[model samples]
Target: MSGEFDFTGQTAIVTGASKGLGRAYALWLATRGCAVVVSNRPAGDGSSSAQAVVEEIVAKGGRAVAHDGPVQTAEAAAAMVEIAATHFGAPDIFISNAGIQAFRPFSTVTLEEMRELLDINLWGCIVGLKAVWPAMVDKGYGRIVLTGSSAGLWGQKQSADYAASKGAMVGLARSVAIDVPKGTDIRVNVIAPAAYTPLSMGSIDPKWADYASPDHVAPVVGWLSSPLCQSSGGIYHAGAGNVRRAQILEGPVHRLAEGDIDTVMHALDRQPEWTSSFASGAEIMPEMVKASGS
Candidate 1:
């Protein structure tokens, strides 16, 4: 089937484009007529994951350039954006997907490991976003897709560091969506992809493997990166050839004008209207204010 979305004359940057979901997203964007910037760390041979995607795009009559560098650094990310502009003009779409995952118990996670996880998974995206924000705002058009994971939404045992970093992505996207300069046509969205990328599914059941291919989640990323997507500051779940809206819902809260320790304990013990999640700050803040009479 033909894709409903087209990105003709647009430029896109896909980090971690050497393999898996990032690769899928880069190739899919190229097929849809986007001039892509495929970025990754500089491999020993001077080739990177970015180069692989660029080659595929070129072979398929699409325009693309490889940006081999460390996206985790501000200088490297800025350089990558500059290269993209030189090759195909300003990037209209940016996908921050560079990350690494390690399995270890919470007690075993070292401070260094935690810092590295947050640096690459969270700060890397922040660097890229800041690098591109200016031109995107100047042009008054931009689409940003941040990589989140199911682990970010639902806690995973033995994945404390990775989960924490991914959770931070949701907060970053939400802040950007609400705080971008007025009149800028920029939209930021998060995708909690449950794909069997290199970073995930090493120990998952083989029979269920088909449900988590990177290709299955590409369409959702494509749609979110398209000009037709009117929604912004939203989170979505994509996998198993299915794309659906994922939301945070607040449970009914109890109001207490003044509560002693016992009263607080009683309210907690009642366990009324329990829900799995809560809505965004936008939705819950008003209720919070009303509840507090603030």
Candidate 2:
């Protein structure tokens, strides 16, 4: 379906929009005519990244307002959400992209460090959802995008804590998608993106930078943020002009199989056929889904 995905007369709230993936998402939404609330951490050096983004949008005749503060704190997240309502109206779209990453071995990771990542990466998104959900519910329309990571999808050697944080997106998105009233027209999805932003620069080779530009991933997000997307609790991986889905596929029930420890271990070693996944968050029995050709 190649229908136009225009955003005229709409409003969006994008966290971490001062740069990176958030910046790309903000600019793309504005280009398509959506007013945006640009939220970012307050720069300590008397400079304003959020203001700079607002200026860029205004220079292009786009409507945007800068809100400074970290979303890691509920107070700051609420303030950031307030600007969207005050400036444009109840937020029609929300992209939770504000987060940080740390590189440490599981053996060396401390409780405080893990807690910090959780507070910012996972809890921060929860707060943003809590803040905007009521108004969106009242309006009876909303599109929510939560950021995930490859580290979370497939565990990383040096990013155990980060993986734990981002992995939470799956449960969160599905739960929210199922909880929304059946006819509300509200949908929540998760995008575990791989882009050449500050988040990945530390580890990726510089040569692959151009291939991994945020521009390549922005279109997928735009689609997720647009009316074209009809599915909820959808999980996707986007980068370098490539898009693929990530689903929780279940294997056949071995409840009837007879097995001792060794036999059971052998059965578990068999690769699960990619024949089925969950039908919805509320589903008690899993159903088979048509596997993608990709």
- Per-candidate TM equals 0.87, 0.89
Model 1, span 1-294: residue lDDT tens: 246777888999999898889999998899989999999998877657567678888999999999888878999999878998999999899999999999889898899988888899988999999999998998999999999866777666788888888888788999999987888778899998766676765744454555557888888899889887777888887766766676666545656755876786576543232121222211222333244343
Task: List the candidate 1 regions with Cα displacement exceeding 4 Å.
Answer: 1-3, 44-46, 206-209, 265-294
Q: Evaluated with lDDT, which candidate comes out highest?
A: 2
lDDT (10s digit) by residue, model 2, range 27-82: 99998889999988789885677998999999998899998876878788788768
Report the poorest 10 consecutive residues by lDDT, candidate 2. Answer: 280-289
lDDT of 1: 0.81
Candidate 2 stretches with Cα past 4 Å from truth are: 1-3, 272-294
